[model samples]
Target chain A: MSCRIGMDVGGTNVVTGLFDSEGRLLRRSKVRTIKLSSCELIQQLAGQCKEILAAEGVRESELEAVGIGLPGFIQSESGVVSSANLPFNDVPVATRLQQLLGVPVAVENDVKMVVYGEYLHGAGKGYSHVLGLTIGTGMASAWVSDGRLHEGAGGLAGEIGHISFPDISYMCGCGMKGCLETVASTAGIARQARDGLKAGWVGLLAERFPPEIRDELTSHDVWQAYLDGDAFAGQVFQRTANWLSRVLVPSIALLSPDVIIVGGGVAAAGDIFFDSLRSYVSASLHPLYRERLRIVPPSLGDDGGLYGSAEFALKSRKIGLRI
Target chain B: MSCRIGMDVGGTNVVTGLFDSEGRLLRRSKVRTIKLSSCELIQQLAGQCKEILAAEGVRESELEAVGIGLPGFIQSESGVVSSANLPFNDVPVATRLQQLLGVPVAVENDVKMVVYGEYLHGAGKGYSHVLGLTIGTGMASAWVSDGRLHEGAGGLAGEIGHISFPDISYMCGCGMKGCLETVASTAGIARQARDGLKAGWVGLLAERFPPEIRDELTSHDVWQAYLDGDAFAGQVFQRTANWLSRVLVPSIALLSPDVIIVGGGVAAAGDIFFDSLRSYVSASLHPLYRERLRIVPPSLGDDGGLYGSAEFALKSRKIGLRI
Candidate 1:
């Protein structure tokens, strides 16, 4: 009757899963994130966990542990989270959650949790060294080598989004000019289309989205135009791929990972995006590094964090209020 | 009576060192590299090793192992080398040298060897995760995490030289345009000065070296001018620092090493170059990453590879003809 609860807390939503002893999902639930204080958010998350467990007819004593994946600067050892999107600034999430749930809880950066999930159960299942890149509202990456994650000294490793792209003059949100995030993220892709529309290179984007609604146009609109064979949209994706390749070239040279698991919203673009990314990266890499390197999308999809957190909680036997 | 021979084979010179059981340097020797064939080159390296051992009065039986650091693509498992500057094209260096010296031999890439050297005994001592950047003829980097090297899947991790700089139009030796090596290396710095001279911005360089012999201008000449308050030379160094910072920004973001050990010819520029690099990198990095990051010069200087190679050989047991 032993069970575990895995939770993924994001800006808009909180997803929780009830997994049985064998690591199989027994039940799942989703609720809108409460943007109140840290204490209130933890209370809401606890309620969601209890609701999911009850739906599966599981007893509170049968719940062995709970694991969470949070977005932002997460200090794994301290379980402290400081995120721009969440109301967590130096908030000790694991301590509060454990106190409420009466079970041990483990916390990790959402991106890293996704990577661990992929490495353990997805596209990176058999790869000895895996680099997972999450290209969504923001750019983030995580690495798992020899079954252990490398969080660097500050636990801020894989923050490649801030890498400068000298050719770019756009101001990044990080107060730096020309950061890779200025163009590599999903928001960056939409901004590219908007910039083009304003600069008169409109093409199908202007015809479809129009200037009145341009500010609200998403990366999906740009991708739609590219699928419709719009040259300008194609150019935008091409530029994104090239700039991404510039970053990947260094990554490949530095890590030489066997497989690069690319997840997040970008995976929805399918082969068109994958082909462009693979070719651009391959063309720039040395023959020595180009051999045996595979770049693929994650097989776990949105459930990566759920599985990753459940597995992480199950594996970490000595979890307590470390903070 | 236990001793070891450490050899570093470069394009211009072959350096060898004899180390006692306690890893202390007992004697050293240097000779010009033989660029005839792989066989002759291996023979030359073998002779250098033997000469150093004889000078130290260490017999073949007393010499526990011989280790060589070669410049180029090296397969540690296979002990094969392929380099641009050397005559080694898939050469079985460890096997050939072990046969000639009647002792176990270990071979590694020159840059990685230097990094391992620094990690074990120099700037990287006491640091758990260390990143070593060698900026000489070309730019290369290596990482040591948890006291073990991350060689990637292809054993070619840390090849940041070829990472593209989209702003520059210069073609790299690797057939890519605007690689980091195009501007971050000593040769690249000299090339920048020469290109400026050709474009009619010949400041102190023209006054000092003159156009008649400007074709032979080296990074040393550029550094000399910068030391004498030359505005143009200062700009060249600043540009190099900025470009190098662009690369390091990504490196810091991805690796988050406690210390970045900068070595090779660029280290000779001292604080003038180091200060510029540190400031630029700090300016771009997020405060989260900027904290506790130290950029330092290697303490072992030219002897890093020697110590690293000897330590590598002594540590690697069951050595045989790996190739």
Candidate 2:
């Protein structure tokens, strides 16, 4: 059994799992992504790995390889840090992990790995063309063409969220004005709702809201409020759906993928986001393609990135081991 | 020499050229595409092929393969008839062409051939990621990833013009509403300009026009007028430039290809198009990618489609002879 470890490195939590050849997860563990300096973060991750091994009752020699999936631009070849999400700059992640764990390591942008999983075993399975989109505080996408993941030149192929979109006027973190993220992301929705509430505008905002809660409203909370029948929340979701569909419909027409796997925390809004998006996308599509574009929820859900990481590690490893 | 013949089938003209192993265009010939039934067109094309062979003093056995490039979708494996521009309705183009021409024939979509040319011998050479865009009567894009032109699951990738966008006020030829072509194509520009002139809007158009040509205008004439520094022409070019850049900036940021080559008649706007598009794209991009994207002209020029057709045919042969 050539078992490997896969980890999704998030700001607050880190989830690691040992997976086998057939995509079955053998063992899993979770830990905090402890706040620390550059050297200390790596040390903490190393400790977590040991903990996972101990908890799984597996020998160190049993582990074949390790794959870590993180957010941002990943230098796949050298495994250096190119994205802004991680603390370390230009850190040789795979090399350091290989030395620490005594096994080969593969690192990739988290969502990119998720896209791989989606195409292989999730909603995108059996399709040679797919666009896996993650809609959270930010937006990002990955491309699968002809049953192969497309890692574009310079590894920046699926950075759709950072690009400027039409009719948007705000600046994005990447310094671009009116990026897709500014209009369609969860953050965009929450912010719009928050502003509307702050202005005392007539909407379905709960008047008995906590003061602290009013200061920091997330898309999650907004969705909850909408389900509670908040008109503003519904309007915000509709706007987000419409705007996102503007980009997505065109993308689908251009790529004509077999499926679109929508992921991320925002997708949890479910029908609120999907209904409007589907309708708008259909209404906007060229007549020749309106009936053919298919959009669906990601089957792998939150663990998509972790599964993809495991798949990548398994494919790249040459040794046999366990968790 | 085992030379191959590459044919680019257009609505009006059918161009056939012989290509050697070294990428040299050995001989060339052309004939009108007989606007007739599917069988008659095939007969006429076969006759044209025979004429070209006899005129070039080449023997039948010397030819290795025949490749045809058309302006619509191609199921290269089955040689399905998918072209909207041609009169043929669901005909077996590759098999019939092979039988008529008495050689191995491979048929491919036109843009596929264009991207192939860029990959093998044009601006896209040595790069693993490339996008070829044409802004003529309609917009079209081709994507080449990792040395291969990516065809989506349904052989429908890279159809950018058909992507639904923000154009809610106009109708597209595809019968879809809000498609990108409604605003970003040469036809779009001409339509806007012609409308402007007919409405008797005050500008340099009236000053430069001879009353006879004021209202009935074309995009090409607008370019020539812009070159002459007509006031209305200046505004026309500026508006068109903005539209072109608006589409390009976000596209480049999202896809992040190694190179984006602009082609088609509207692309010949040269600096009139390139200069503004550069500034606009830079302004539209995230700071991280401001310096990453490169915009260039098509090196293969009008011949790019021809060369791309040759490469696509040769490559398709490796996948399977098809016929």
Candidate 3:
């Protein structure tokens, strides 16, 4: 039986999955990501893939291809990755991995892979145009149309996180001021709450987390506080939703996507976040667009990128044969 | 010789162009668009198509298809047009025209057609992903990827004119406040200049046009005054360029098209407009994106939609036959 391996390479860990020809996950494995040179990191990823196949009782010759989802700027056409999260700087990942495994390989941006997985099996199924927004430690988006990713000319598409928001003074890690991600991401929400606490805003956060631990606050704590009826925490999520709508409104007006998939850690905040985002975006959009567009939470959870990468490998192999 | 006819149907007039199989324009004709019912308007369009073919000495049987570019909502799959500019309200434009001419017919948004034209034979040639911005009386955009228009699921993809701008209170015709078109478009520029004049700001506009004809102030007059060293007129264009950047920056970050073709009446403002817009956008975009993207002026001039619609009809005929 032909099988494929899909790897989700992140800053802290690398998760690899074994998938059958039909895209069903058979087994999974994880390894810590250590700071290493580009060559060493590629070898580590290659080792993980081999171990997953061996442990699943599959021979190396039985493998069809491997797909990897990595963070940062991925030029899939060139198989190069340039991202701050990983020790990759214009690294030709696909070529290196294919050499190590002696099989075909495909690589894409992690968020894009997540969106693709959703497009194939989750909230985006049957949709022609999908705009996927991932609000994690940072905010980014990806677009999928007709089963193919719209990677733009230079593969820098879907960087809505870096778009400058009006009247915002926060400095983004991108070296730009007022980027949407500076105030809309998981880190952004936590930062907002921390700023409020430092400014001496009296709220549940100060009464509970206290001054010493204020610096250690996470978006989860603020969300929990909001759930517990904290007014200040409520405003943080509300403002994030509003800033998020600024990005979505233009996206809706420009793309008219069938579905806007809100995924990542921020999405885990659930109804409190989604309800306000949906209502704000709907109210801001023209009735023509509002009536047809669906904004929904992702369903596949963490394995979306794995599923997407495996499926992408199978599809890429088919395309390779055709060419 | 086999040929196609493309019609650009606008509120003021209808311009039709006959093209040979190779997509070269062979003949052109125009007629005023008067108020008429949907049925009457369809009949009028048919008459215009027939007249254009007859004038070019091309028999009806020699025509392959007819394509029309119209303002407002176009559901090309169903051949229906629901536009506010013309009498077409869910009218089956393609079906009616095909019936009258006994040839295949296609309909698309006017802006999409213009973008398609540019992609095929103008500044957007040799590029895979193209984003076209049309800043006329109102602002709008269209995208073409690999020679196919990204029409979105609901066929309302390129309505950027309706996206609200922060801090602007001017009401848009779309019933939204602070729409980008409220200040970035040709009409919007004139409106700002008029507002400045009406508020008793000192400038050449008041000294020349005076209060009586102030209501009749046009973008052309403002451009001319700016060229002649009117600080108020200069500020109007400068601010308009700034607002235009707000739309372009997000578009760049999200779409990352190889080329952004700036077209329509406002492009006529020349360097005084494009120079400022380009610099602001270039400064704002990350070097990764800025290096590969080209922000260019439209090359097809007034006939972009005409060329695009004709080419689209020919392509549609091929698709129709394959199905």
Candidate maximizing lDDT = 3
Colliding pairs, model 2: A62-A321, A62-A322, A63-A322, A287-B176, B113-B308, B117-B308, B204-B232
Give lDDT tens digits, candidate 2, residues A226-310.
8988887887888888767755765765567778888887777899888887888877655445556777889976677778887
Give residue A131's lDDT in candidate 3 (0 to 100): 91
Highest DockQ among the candidates is held by which one? 3
- The CAPRI quality class of candidate 1 comes to medium
Cα deviation of A208 in candidate 3 (Å)? 3.4
- What lDDT score is found at residue A156 in candidate 3? 85
Once model 3 is optimally superposed onto the true structure by TM-score, how far is the C-alpha of residue B185 displaced, in angstroms? 2.6
- Model 2 off-target regions past 4 Å? A210-213, A317-323, B164-168, B207-215
What are the per-residue Cα lDDT tens digits for candidate 1 across B135-176?
889888888898776778868787888877557788999887
Global Cα lDDT for candidate 1: 0.84
Candidate 3 displacement at residue A224 in angstroms: 2.6
Better of 1 and 2 by DockQ: 2
**Cα lDDT of model 1 by residue, A1-323, tens digit:** 89998888899999998999998888878899855778889899989988988888888999988889888888878788898889998998888988988888888889888898889888899888999988888888888888877889878898888876557888888787888888988988998889999989757788987778889999999899989989898888778877777667677888889899887775567777788899888877777777776999999878889988888877764433342
Question: What is the RMSD of candidate 3?
Answer: 2.1
CAPRI band of model 3? medium
TM-score of 2: 0.93
